[model samples]
Target: MTYLCLGLSICVSIPTYISFMYIRTLRLNTRFIIVRNIVLSVCLRDLMFLFTDFVTSLASKPSYLCEVTGALLQYMSTCAFLWMLCASTDIWLKVHFPYFNHANNIYFYRSLSYISPMFIVCATIGGFRSGYVDENSCWLSITSQSMWVFYSTAIVLIVLISIELAMVACKTTQALKNSVQPANIASTKDPKQSRNMAKSFLPLLAVFGITWILGIFLVIGGTIIFDLLFVIVNGLQGFVLFLSQFLFSKQVHNAWTESKERATTRTL
Candidate 1:
């Protein structure tokens, strides 16, 4: 069940992320770049997870394979969450302080997405050499100390996502209140665009929240129910991300529609 869902998620998300890559407008936008990177990271992480699981099942004692896969798993999964943090932070700043220039710091945001996770994963691996395939799974087995690092990261992300969601809610309410004004009526951009923009993060938050919460619970105790929950939620992570990008995002949606039309015309 776990592999099945993760496989399906990868199948859907990779093409969706690739579609964004080809869309000039989405490719150029700083916020969308963050989102695309997030999708890319999640897809990579899920693919790695599936591959490692398959390899582990086939070779009982694949020497040093566990360490490599575990390190990569840690790095990629951490990157996914951190990139999501960057996206939320970027979006919140854009919404709250509309004039602030994010374009100048796109490099900075991109650096965080890659660098921080590499540093943490390297430190963890070097300090303890901490990755081995257990009887049932191939991952960084959670010791008391290592578990802290993992869960702590998730906790911080959850807090940041929560704060971003609250800010978005407040902004959406204010936008709605002002949307009734005559001056707002005269604005060039659709007022609904702002509301839609604010609501976009809701699905993101829901996906991150549900997946990580299941992870945290699994750490606390594992039963059949929690195992099932973890598999389904974690497996859905990539697909949820793809849906958030392709379905909810207006720019991506428009670009995708245009791409399909172009393809259809060429086929004729």
Candidate 2:
């Protein structure tokens, strides 16, 4: 089951990441930029897990390899979470403030998304010395308190993102209501526009929030039922992401259709 899950995640994630890279229209949007990074990070994380946890376990390997893989996994997972937070915060600011400067602060967001996790992983290794890797697996040692660093960081980021998304939802709802009133209808913007804006953030919020929250629980310990649930939901995250970000995206479909039409026109 674990192997199946990992296989599915890698298969889905690699192709999805490649599609995002090749699709010019997808790259033009700031939101897609953040999402691209998220997908990349998750892809790397799953690959590392497959290698260190499954492959290495089958063979005799040095201890340092496990430690190194543990650190890489930690960094990639944290980076994915941070990117999700950035996405939520970006949408929240845009919804609340019409002129939020996402383009200007994109570099800052990217830096935080990537560098912050590196810093955390480095600090954990430095502070704990030999405590980073567990004896039984290529992951943080729960006994040495190193695992909490990742868990605590994840929990905090999840809470902050949830708050930001909740506020965005409330603000969007209020705006939608205001747009419908007779007196405000003339002055208000289109409710459909507001709804579309809200819809854009929902996939990220639902996928990242629910899966990771369940993942944290599964890691901490859970029943067989919960473990199976986690394996299905959390393991197939890449598939879900592909569905939400690409397959169901009208923009991507339009972009692909237009590109094909242009190619055919040139050929004719």
Which candidate number has the best lDDT? 2
Model 1 worst lDDT window (10 residues): 181-190
lDDT of 1 by residue, 27-53 (tens): 887767888888888889998988788
Candidate lDDT scores, in order, read 0.74, 0.76
Candidate 1 to truth, TM: 0.85
Best by TM-score: 2
Q: Candidate 1: lDDT over CA atoms? A: 0.74
Clashes of 2: 0
| Residue range 1-268, candidate 2, lDDT tens digits | 7778767878988888787777787776777788788888878887887876664565677788888889989998899889888888777666656554558767988899989888999999998887788857878887788888888898899889878877766766776676553332222265444445447656765766676667677667868877787667666767667777778877778878977888899999
Residue 203 of model 2 has an lDDT of 73
